[model samples]
Target: MSSGSFIMSILDEAPTLAQPRSTPKHEFKGHKSNIWSFVFLHDNVHIVSGSEDGMMCKWDCDTGLLVGEPWESEGGSINALALSPDGKTISCGRYNGSVEMWNTDGEMSEDILTGHTTWVSALSWSPSGAHIASGSNDGIILIQKAGNGEVEPEVGLMKMRQLEGRVMCLAYSHLGDRIASGAYNKTICILDNNTGKLLVGPIEDLGGLMKSVVWSLDDSKLYSASDKFARVFDSTEGTELYRFEHESFIYSVALSPKHNVLACVGEDGVAQLWDTESHEPLGQLFHQEDRKLLRCMSFSRDGQYLAYGGDHENITLWVLRVIAPELLVRAFMIILQVEKPYSRTLHPCLHHSPASRQVLSP
Candidate 1:
């Protein structure tokens, strides 16, 4: 094996510390207004955020430094942001009822898309990076192609749907075959992306206004955030599976892709982590103050890092330690399995050999 691989193997066999507690790793500041949405890029090393100040900023996760000058949006206060699957571009939703796309690798240009009649509140990119979905207060959802350049405002476009109430959040399934949207009317809708048919919901009156919606890694379950709780639902049956209680209204929920960790942040000023299968609280990460609501949270694709924004104008990054303890135990077991037979052959106590029996007969 290569020297690097050998070193890594040695490190893996070493006794690891207890689940490493999360600490405030880095803080990205300078949003003049509240940051409404942020997402980690696919590379997991960069984060892009949008704010009510009409600014979109990118940051390097390792250094907590701004990547470039903040990009200004002409659509007024930016409300939501989503990164393309390849991480080369980002889409921003604004209060002016427009969705804009910018190439993150090049100069930031206003590739404005005008479609929504009211403020655009939610934006999500399809898994395949082919389409971008935007939701607005006008009760409309628009799915536009990724490289469409610029678009003009139209009431009923080719890929548009008018739901019951103002759409507040949107998420695309992992397969890119369906879209789930949560609205101001306390309803969650799952629509077939190909046929534009309502597939699952109008999951109405979910205890409070639906603030956010996310899909499980396998796309078999849906998790929604709302007043005082985050609820999980079976994707196929549309039945409630579990309801996670929160101290205050939940603003966002994120599921780890590589582990069964579920994280939620909200009005309580605490980011809580949970075991998705056991329904047990794993840990709580508190903000600087106790009353400021956390507005948005996201998990990196690898599930090793988490990023959240709040009313405090700063975005906080955390290193999630959910899998460390388990890994440590597994490493110990592997060593034990390999050494057990050799130990039994050398140690008489492990086998009832005649000499061992005679010695023990005393």
Candidate 2:
């Protein structure tokens, strides 16, 4: 087929567009207090969230309804959550400095693990699913066995390290060989996942308190959100690569599980998407007018859905497939011909506005 014919055929396969609405597709209502954290299950349809109300609830994103009974936290104020790689287990960190594990089958089997003396603020399950890492307000990060609730000094507890500030966020590298952590002291650290040795930092002098950290899919770079900027860094050298600046303090940063898009929300209550490769805004933005801060967010495994929550009692799920039909088509084009340059003028369907056509990145 001629090159023009091939491009036309690809555009023909683009899905139909729905009238975009500024409102969220689904607002999952259950938590009575601020929603702090959440994660999408491997199925990509169910999402589990933890909140300041000390409850963890699972919701079916497709139906916008609760999946089963909400699990009450033994420790008050569940602060963070992580799901095992197999998706069968979810680990919850609470304000009481304890980590609780539950089976996803709706059976509330409590394998409570305790060590830190204050709030457990962050949790990350190793990509291999063999270990769970919990970070606490006490400035400690503990690695323990995921099975049988082992924290025994000799058998279950694998490694532990103390940081200079309250650990705010933690994320395991895709390769599971390292962990990147952000702390309240305005520092970022990369530690060897097995030995608990600091491999890269206490890399200090970051612009502000580190709010979130995530590794590139290839594990070569790390991304973090702070006061007024989200930065890119070399995962191995601990060097800054670039930054995305915002008008307000950034609360969270999430990379799509299957795409090179990065999504972040801030104190301005506006969520922005960016091209991870080019470090440019993707033109699609979601604004939450009711809330001043969007504290947390997660992307579905398929990269077609997004969930974000904050000071409000509910989480909002955005169906990207419906909200940005042309954006997804541009994403498809990027994946297919990343090396080729294209004219800035977008297809007629994407000509809704000059801002919407920004996804036609070269």
Candidate 3:
């Protein structure tokens, strides 16, 4: 199973792996309502979730410990949640147009700032953890600076550029230099962090509403989902590099920190694992029959664990290791070739003149 020509030798061969014989490694049970907001923080040691039960709780991602008493939030429906890069500060946004920023010490700022008029759909902190960004269904995006003393978002900046529709998701790149947001207007925006300017042409999908958008570890490309296909796009040029079709709408997508493997969770209760470099699905994860319909999925920072759960009120965590490919690339193609321009004479319709007997160009 080793050779310098290994990749070339197995170009036409498919990938094979030992099948997993057991159920999902861990099944956490606690939430009485649907768990819609889930995220792993502090290097995946802790997981935070918010639900329709009007409460947010933190859990030990490894052991599922209830870190603290769940608090009833003012926002009736928990729309989104975020943990600072340090995992010390957590923020919860609600459907009732209010946001609460909290920490392990308790509520840092209660009823601090509010007014979106709709659900707060997405939230993320800058990589440097200096500022926080939130997007909402009302189409307003805000950037707020954490308070130093006993204050709540004492300093903040509101973006003047509106996406013209509801904001679906927001993400900050690993480098902290760029931020990407998907909107209901059928477009995704990659913005320059320094200037707060839109950089890339709005990335759009055919379905008109993107499910999610995430940046690869190196920030070289972006993985996006729409309808039934997961697509990888060049982060710089906004050009699609690969398109992998799924059986149903992709609920979420996760890329390993090393940027070699990807996991896609679809609406049909199937978790798809793929070799990102080759753009091929390698394995599939199946949940219990009635527990399928996953609404979210996430991978730890180290890529050693994958966790997913949904309306079933349970979180399933799985353990995995990346297996080095024993094959080599025998076939590869570069898509840099330019396409030929239109040639009217090459039309499929036959054209003949009875007088000159020469075909005329349309």
lDDT of each: 0.76, 0.79, 0.66
Task: Write model 3 residue lDDT over 1-362, tens digit each, in one string.
Answer: 43223422343242333323435656777788777677777656767777877777667766766777776756688878777888788778788876677775446465344657788888888888877777888887777665431212422333424467688888899998888888777777888877677788587654747657889878999888766778888889998898878778786777767446777776787777777876755545555457466767777776667787777877777765323221111111111122123122221111222211221211
Of the two candidates 1 and 2, the one with more favorable TM-score, higher being better, is 2
The model with the greatest TM-score is 2
Window of ten residues with lowest summed lDDT in model 3 = 327-336
Candidate 1 per-residue lDDT, tens place, 255-358, comes to 88887878888987788877788787654445645457798998888777888997888899876643233332333345556655433333222133453343
Stretches off by above 4 angstroms in model 3 are 1-16, 104-108, 148-162, 322-362
**In the order shown, what is each candidate's alpha-carbon RMSD?**
7.9, 4.3, 13.3
**Pairs with backbone N, CA or C atoms under 3 Å apart (clashes), candidate 2:** none
TM-score of each: 0.82, 0.86, 0.76
Q: Please give the distance, in angstroms, between residue 53's alpha carbon in candidate 1 and its true position after superposition.
A: 0.7
- lDDT per residue (tens digit) for residues 1-362 in model 2: 75545655555554444334446778889898988898889898998988999988889988999987898846899889888888898898988888888777555555688888999999998888888888888877777777765653532332334356588999999998898888888898898776666789777887788889988888999989987888899999999888888768999998887767788888888888777877766545787768468889889988879889888778899876554555666655664575254434345555554544554434
Selected candidate, larger lDDT, 1 vs 3: 1
Q: For model 2, what is the C-alpha lDDT against the true structure?
A: 0.79
Q: For candidate 2, which ten residues in a row score worst on lDDT? A: 152-161
- lDDT, candidate 1, residue 139? 83
